[model samples]
Target: MMNKLYIGNLSPAVTAEDLRQLFGDRKLPLAGQVLLKSGYAFVDYPDQNWAIRAIETLSGKVELHGKIMEVDYSVSKKLRSRRIQIRNIPPHLQWEVLDGLLAQYGTVENVEQVNTDTETAVVNVTYATREEAKIAIEKLSGHQFENYSFKISYIPDEEFVGAIIGKEGLTIKNITKQTQSRVDIHRKENSGAAEKPVTIHATPEGTSEACRMILEIMQKEADETKLAEEIPLKILAHNGLVGRLIGKEGRNLKKIEHETGTKITISSLQDLSIYNPERTITVKGTVEACASAEIEIMKKLREAFENDMLAVNQQANLIPGLNLSALGIFSTGLSVLPPPAGPRGAPPAPPYHPFATHSGYFSSLYPPHQFSPFPHHHSYPEQEIVNLFIPTQAVGAIIGKKGAHIKQLARFAGASIKIAPAEGPDVSERMVIITGPPEAQFKAQGRIFGKLKEENFFNPKEEVKLEAHIRVPSSTAGRVIGKGGKTVNELQNLTSAEVIVPRDQTPDENEEVIVRIIGHFFASQTAQRKIREIVQQVKQQEQKYPQGVASQRSK
Candidate 1:
């Protein structure tokens, strides 16, 4: 398999394709698709030779987007594996502890405490693969167990033994399973149920683990079998007085004990495990007191648990922001919601006319204004109607779904805004007309501009290129362009700038009026700005300026 190299210091804007293009251009024979992670990428080269060359040639030499790249030969996978083995050893360990810890990383054939002829504990050792054993010996030579401690050695067994029989029969079975070793165990035990020595026959690395597993299983079963029972019961009663219910101390308690012939334990209130919170007392011994004690403990627990839960809930309620009543964001400053009105008592709401001039999202919050009884009444002279058309997409957002927008608008503009309805052919048209005192309309427009300013819809000082193109049919061009395009009657009447149509030999034949907008960044950029200003004005006019109402500008 090809080796993988981890590449780092990538710019956030860089993509996987970009990396591949860079390497491909440099003639690097990458073997597979580049893998990209959140902050880095990895590339695999077909051969170690290519990998080494790339490392030497490109290390600290490649540049990306003006930044120098960092590179090095990636560590071989085998070396990485060895590093993991040495670093994860558990602390304050023994043979068994180390075996369990290392087992998680990979198979640990056997972890044995080596002993000399005199049976003195020498060193605890382990192994992964047979080959790894040799690697271990060379790497761990003269190594100390701790800081400046005993020197230990990891000597590789010569042609590591393919078999290692354990202390008993169970040992070989567990080892066989753990290490996937197909080994046989020769039994040497008598009539006694205890397992005998077990022989594990497998590869060197496999034999040790098979033996380890067998030993662990047998040890567990033995522990379960050897057991003990606790003493039955012991009951101590109050001294003397056997007569209160037998009431008095021992008289009462002892009478019951005697009658039942079972010992009983009775103690004074101070001696009992019950205080004021647990005022009830009971004799605990024999079946009778045991049952009674259970009843008393249950009663006390219920009371304690209930009281604790209530206290916790109350503490949580006292925190400020957590309580709904403390916030004034949307709701009026009313604590309890008023009960729903009865059928006859509740008044009907004003009609909701979507296309009506002034209705907006927050309209319901304001008091209703009385419309003139006469259907056709005019309040202003000249009665000029200026139709401001906002994009249909912006209508809902500006109106805020409900009448909130229009209400806020009317309140600020000091005029009335009427939204034209959605009729069959004009469905896409969103027309808002302002009608009121002329001064109010002007004030409302300014207020709308201010609202758009707050919403970041306008950039008054931004400069942009502007261009306009007008075209006419070839036959009409003579009349439209005039001689030398000087007396261009059509262009002069329609727009401030000269209009041009390329006089190529073969012109586009479809010939219809074409108005092309080019280089006019300034004007086109102001489209949204101008629309937003108009929407804001409509909103202010729809708002009610009456007392006690708060005005909201879309933030």
Candidate 2:
């Protein structure tokens, strides 16, 4: 059987297309075209689940031009085994209407409408129990006395409705899942009334806890709403109610919903009632949830309410709003609002504290005192000092390839200058020292440092150990060594650097002379260069002859 439902009291503006589009958007395939009657329409869904969800969600809600909507199962087409006769049916209604209404509960075997001969066409209708006709009878009871009336000869437990449905239709599904017991919920706007009962049927065991759980879930879902809380909890109360519960900008209703995990709506009248009349704040949620929100909101509101009430009463007793106002009220009776916090939670810095004047001494972190007058003594000033180290090679550069650079730099900076000798065997290594005020020393150092660094006078050198061998005829040896080494003494004077020659016949080589240059890195390099020049000259001048005496110099 199709799960056809009836929708009624739609706005005149509502069209069949609007209804079709709503279901289409939900992805519900329409089993049949919507039958749009004057103020109502019938929709058939593929199954019972969609029908139940639709009823649970949209029942009693207004849509389409502010018209309240009503939904219910369609009448059955088959006959029933048992049913009470319901007559005086609306003339506008037809036998098809009865068939659609009773069919939702069980198999509807028959529906017959008996009409009077009167031109008004008042009539009687009968349905079989096989259709679970009792459900149709109950739902129609209140409605029949008015537009539609019912005479129920049998009664079904109201709670049994939910039991028959199952959890979100699970109970119904279990019986119908395999065998096809499609249960549909056609809810009308009058569901809250005792006379307007929900219908149910399918497998005999169809009515179970499944419906109860599902109905509970639906009701809970419909009731819950939420919002974020801001502002101090203390100021939330108004007229003795917690003000925060009202919410910043009147969102307290939202807070109650969120806190209780249930939906709550506050009527505009109820909001005014909080302060003017009843002074009660209504909250909705799960039983426990609502209670929690209620306590908190009420406590806050009460505190604020009481304080305000006290203030008003006191003002009336002490200071009249009209009549001659006392100057005392304007002056001493006012209370000031507290000031906001300072930057970064810090107190303002204290004003500058000037130390008491004293000629003897002064000491402080700020505005340090001038030096005290006392007997003159030698001591370095309390200021920064920059020590400079110059390489020996750079010393000559600072001296300016001569001594002129040092003299000029010293005069420019008002600094005393001392330059040490160039590093060499005959000359002691030199150093230029500058001492003066920081400013003067800094200027002098800058000039000297910049010149030396830019010129890059320091050159890298390699240390090479050398062994020179000389061969001399045995005959010429005695002559070269002249009485008591007079000739060697002259050679020693000729070269400032050390010179050593092996003296005895036991020596391995025929003859050899070794010289070593020891000085600063650059000085040693220069000395080596000079020694090489001298050696080259001697080699050119002195010529060897086999078993011969010294040769004369050749041009």
Candidate 3:
């Protein structure tokens, strides 16, 4: 026994000064020294009496950081030196060979070869004195016997032993084969230590390799235990399009699962209510596998979205007098219709020009269509606009110190973004307006969403939900809502957002009705873009048939 007490379960914030103050408050005599660690500490006293008193008084009685401290007398480490356990001895090594090896260092009073399993054994060589055992350990700890290197260490905790052995001893067998080392975990016969000594028998290289393998396995087990307590990744997707993501008879989702080794399950249709048309998609796997699955899932969803957009565009094209140019549909320089034939024998409609004046005035509200649907490459940046409502508390994180973060974000996203002032003193949220092409919108809005998440605006276990508002002509609201709400339902399916055009709402000065979109950042942005397209279509229809519009207005 030593005149020192071990103090465990200490808070990291506890300092030497705090310890001294605590001792003073308790009226305990000063200790000789204090050795502090992350979550444990050691204190030396002037004599054994003080140490004993400290243990009696403080053990399980003192509290720090919500944990009761564990105090006990320090055990003398020197006592363990006499009992030397030689590990990682090649299984083929006869008992005579091991005996001869230990004989060189000291008189081996007792040599017990405890067979832990068929392929591994531990030899406990107890010398007559501690000096002999120490000498043997120092000289032969790293010595190579055949192809196995010796690994010598004190016993580990019982938990580590259970982890090493695994269920039905399968883990140890795998580790033995992988590291080419025989691992022997001794059973504890006394209460001196919570765990028995584990020894490895192998070549010097194999001994080190075995140690690494064991540590890695232990770490993996710990990580898995922690993850078991965490929530699975829940992705909200539109109820209608989730079928597309699942593929024809769940083939798409099955393929993603096979490739990524992750299990995915979507919420049942019964879970859907008027408030939440989106279904929750739960992904379960290790972090890396979950991330891979997310990528695959999103890829399938994007493809579905592109196809849906193409279908919608085709439908819009059939509406007589719909100006694709005014709607910025041909900004990608793709010809939706052949150019008009020149007067008389002139060359039939000169080759299409990208900068043709007929393309109409480009608006920042909607980005130019520089890329075709599923284009292989984007040569020029196209502009897009998105409006976000962020909690006021999280705005500082997005802005950073003196606007450094915001400036960097603008440059990185290649977009012009601004945060509007608070509407009033009571408002808890502010509007973040972002203008950029698709890539820019992705970067800028993604950063804003990420910033809010990092700042803990939403619980770590929950997905971040955001609201975005866009304005469209009141007349276009009918088309957006569609006949019997079919169009809005399709938009929600395509974007995975809750689209609400409040009924009988008064229009703004511009005769525009506000469409409220709510969902995760990506879903809300997608819904906004789709609604803008509908607004553009309505504008073109009004321009094409003024007489028909007037007649409808009169009616």
Candidate 4:
């Protein structure tokens, strides 16, 4: 609803002043600078009424420098319609008299009266056709109506209603600042909904620029809405803690709502099936609000999970000769613990995970990539980002001949490989960021390791090995270690890879901890899979066995 007009089809010789004189001839005042473009120009009006009057008087009717130009509300930036505004009408002026005055020039369609701060009545008159509206402006200007003269202007009528302006009109403010325009978003007459039809009072160019920015913001919002719908705030939680979360008569849930400004809903118990034992607590709110609710929700679920683990811990020989606390990291991301000795050597039930039906939890949770048509080889094990440290001196060799070698390596492994900038000139090791699926990570890392060896960075007889890091949820870190370091030890035995979880290390902002796997290719890969599998089991564990312990615990 910008009070900006697009003066199009201008002759090449017409300057800003020429266009100004054209509007000036009709007593139309240019509010700001005229934005002159190649074949057209834009002119602003402080009063939307004048903008409308200009359109009515001159659009496709007037000539400038031998060119009949198009003059009207900026069709792209502002809403447009066939309406003329008559302002400052004395309250005593009868509707009949107003209708008579309007009918002399055009077919009167509708008159919408709006409340004014002053005692005078303001009516927006719509005509049956644009031609009639144009004629009405000419006949109506400076016409006497009792004690008040008709203050005439154009009423922009377009379809930018029912759109969000922004959180606190900041979006509108930003558009004006960025485009050097002034937008009237709070005019009482324009207030309809969050989608307030705004008019930017600036140079003609700034007005159009502001409109484009507004459209960009709108498109971004649309994309975000779609993305939000596709990936909802789905939090997987244990069923045992769900009651505590709800509290007595849903008081806890109400408290959470009050604290976080979010509405929380849990998956119904009746919908629970054996395949998916975990309860889903879906919280809905703004992003920051949802994050706050998650922190509170996760705190309660983590307590419940630990309590269940505590009960399981009390009953020793659960996994026979393994302490739950001793478990730690191992080669790659493997979590290794001998399955509970099942019924006198019947072999472990193939490590079934509630959420993962694939080759157990390890291959399912961390990997987002599906294998590429290779039956005998390992199926795609999701995408992984491994930061492998290499000697600083070997950087040139890897980058080689205008970056040809690294580019070739990336294509070969189908991974993104980049050497991070050195921290200082004397730094011993520089980080190489490798991003790809497990096979890609293995291939890229293998090449880097072999390259270092070939470059004689290591002794001739020494086996090439490197340390790789992977992040896991902080909750799963304990399971990676297991009770008394049992899992880490078992994974080393399982994969011949050295894996270590740093002690006294804090989880990152994402609530994840890094596990370092130091070993040759196969060993690290095996360990990572084993560890991720354990994480999957821990997260998707059925609480049926815990129900006995869970029920007996006092509130």
Question: Over the stretch 1-555, how does candidate 1's per-residue lDDT look in tens digits?
Answer: 233455656666778888778777877755465666555556655443455445445545787766555443233221212111122122354766545544554556555442222112333344555445446545544435554222222221211111223334354455557776665322211110011112333443454344334323333332342312111121112111111223444464455555545444433434221001011223324334433332332233323433433432332121112222121111110000000000111121111100000011011111111111212222333222334444454455456658887777777656687677765654654666666553344334334333433332333221112232333334443333446654343333322233344445344666534323232221221221222233334435446553322232211
| Model 4's TM-score against the true structure | 0.31
For all predicted structures, in order, the TM-scores are 0.19, 0.19, 0.39, 0.31
List candidate 3 segments past 4 Å from native: 1-385, 437-439, 549-555
On residues 1-555, what C-alpha lDDT tens digit does candidate 2 reach at each position?
A: 134465767777888888877667756546455767667776655334455445434546536668877764433221111433343355666656655766666665434443334222322233333345556656765455344444332211122233335458676566446433344443332221111123323232332222223333333322331111110011111222334446687676676566667543332333222111112233334435543543444444434544544432332121112111111111001000100111111221111110100111111110111211212222324232223445555666777746787888778766787764555654423445556653354355546544543453422121111112233444344434445766444444433323333455543264433333332222222233333333434544454443233442211
Q: Model 1 off-target regions past 4 Å?
A: 1-8, 11-384, 423-429, 449-555
Tell me the spans in candidate 2 whose CA falls farther than 4 Å from its real position. Answer: 1-247, 250-265, 268-286, 308-555
Find the candidate with the highest TM-score and give its number.
3
Model 3 C-alpha lDDT per residue in residues 453-490, reported as the tens digit of each score: 55658753345678877777787787888878888898
Ranked by TM-score from best down, the candidates are 3, 4, 2, 1
Q: Looking at candidate 1, what is the lDDT of residue 513? A: 42
Residue 23 in candidate 3, Cα distance off native in Å: 22
- How does residue 318 of candidate 4 score in lDDT? 21
Query: How displaced is residue 11 in candidate 4, in Å?
Result: 99
- Which lDDT values do the candidates have, in the order given? 0.35, 0.38, 0.57, 0.56
Candidate 4 wrongly placed segments (more than 4 Å): 1-381, 542-555
Q: What lDDT does model 1 reach?
A: 0.35
**Cα lDDT tens digits for candidate 4, 1-555:** 135556778788988888778778878766456777677776655444555557657866887778887775443212223566676688888888878888898778678785544467778787866667767877887788666777665554322221325545566566667878665543353321111324345443554455445444443443543422211234544355577768799997898889999877776765332222345566666546655665566556545545544432332112223221121111111011100110111221111100100111111011111122222332445777788877788899889899999998898778999999999989988889999876576567766765765566764334457677888877677778877888778778766789898866799999989999988654666676667666656655535454443332222
**lDDT: worst 10-residue window of model 1:** 333-342
